[model samples]
Target: MSMSYIDKNYIYAVSRIRYAELRLLDGSVFDRLIEAKDVAECITILAEKGFGGEYRDPEGMLGYEKSRLWELIAELVPDMSVFDVFRLQNDYSNLKAAIKESALDLDIPGIYSQEAVADPMLIKQAVRERRYKELPLEMADIAELCHELFLRTGDGQLCDIMIDRAAMEAILRAAEASKEPVLIEYSRLTVGASDIKIAVRAMLTGKDDEFLRRALAPCPLLDTELLIRAALSGMDELCAYLMNTDFKDAVTELRKSLAAFEKYCDDLIIERLGTQKWNSFGLGPIAAYILARETEIRSVRILLTAKQNGFSAESIRERMRRTYV
Candidate 1:
């Protein structure tokens, strides 16, 4: 779990990942899904690809794929903690949902993700009982803070932002501590992109400086203070700032819409993951495979949603996230 992922120990794991990567859904498979007459047909096509394997609903099949992906990685690695960077967001999401449920005195198990390191039930109980110690260290204080903040201010939006920032912060710390270059870059992209999203949303929603400051998480890839200044001014200022950074390409998507910008961000992450496929050793390929599967699962979910909702294939084809395959 230390920063020693680039050695012989990972060779076999990388080999397994290499084979696993081959099974990742390519464009042709996605095409089949899109062309399928209905959601059931899509699952049938998925089965042909070894994904729609179990006879479950679309959501259940996707859940099975995600669980199967994680199980494969855990089987290959000696320590799973190094992979915490990938799971942190889900943990925080569960925390956020738990806090909301606590405030409302409600229980909604469906809101919790199964992919997180933290158990959803534990988080629900911790928040409901006001027992912060029951949560992870990175989440404990923030959980308590958001739990009480919602009760005090009745501002669910504020609580959401705080929890999100906390999630970004925790993820960055985990990535940097791992000392994996790909992991580090992945973390930076996540944090920086998230910051831009917050900034853009602030500009679009008339959020004040206090909200922007509270929402943005620090990323070494960009100047945080400058981002705040630009966001406070307007979209032009924000786009101008983004144009000068490594994320200059994001400027066009930023101009389009938040959804387009988000899709661009996801595709960029996949572009980063692309390099891992050529790697024959170390954790990069395994890590990349994890993300690749995530992208694949997410895209499949999107496609299924489009099918269920009668969304046009053209609309989805334009925004479907790039796959690692």
Candidate 2:
């Protein structure tokens, strides 16, 4: 497609998103939130910022804000499937929840996420009935495999690993098929970072090479085989291997703790996507807005949780993600 055509197509959505981006919370807002004396104070800050309005509890507030975010996206974007790469993870999560709930014969409420490309209820029904035809081909196949694996082996971890790897693969495939640079870059970074986290955790827990191989998805930035080998060796070897990759900067955070490493990954994504703010037209800005809002909500959640748990302001600050504004 021509650049002009793509730009024209996304003009309205981008324009709307530009206005929406103005409401996004900045670093100072997050700082105030972190410094809040209590959860009530944190909620007051969020309310002033027009987030989680009238929802006193954190869970309800966050959930309402998330639904509002997607609702806005659905209103602005004509073709929702273009952003399926972002929502497919939620679909897979619901699939995982449904499969486990059905297998264990338990009624787990609020376990499914609302931001899915597919209907969570449909996924739950399909898994319950063993009706794979109801789901998308990619999800259907994995759902069947994971359902049977969970049933036969009773190993939730294995099932989770399978579904998680499949979710990453699906994301990569969607990014490629969309032919959008922003989506492609996001997918590459997301998968690469996930693989790194998996390697780090596996090495710490002494998981074998086979588990690492199975867990890590293929991304352009990182060599999966080398990562597997490095993970099998040790954290130092893995860190050394990572030093030669795009994630070298994250090595220091990785050495700190998993939470710090995750914060580093989120910050990297925000830094990369921040460039989209200058683009006058195209899906990039809209996508960036969506991610920015999500990041803001997550930072708020961290603050509220920390305040509720009586965590120190410095500790909460260390865990806060970078803002996109």
- TM-score versus the correct structure, for each prediction: 0.95, 0.96
Compose the digit string of candidate 2's lDDT tens values, residues 247-281: 99999999999889999999998899999999977
Clashing pairs in model 1, backbone N/Cα/C closer than 3 A: 46-52
How large an RMSD does model 1 have?
A: 2.2
Q: What is each predicted model's overall lDDT from 0 to 1?
A: 0.88, 0.89
Q: What does candidate 1 score on TM?
A: 0.95
lDDT winner: 2
**TM-score, cand. 2 vs. native:** 0.96
- Go through the candidates in order and give the clash count of each: 1, 0
Off by over 4 Å in 2: 1-7
* Candidate 1 local lDDT, 1-325, one digit each (tens): 5576545459988988888888999988888778888888988888888894675688778888888999999899877888899999999999989888889888665899888988888988988999899788879999988888899988998999999999999999999998888899899998999999999888888988888889999899989999999998888998999999979999999899898999999999889879888888788888889888998999999989988999888887876888888
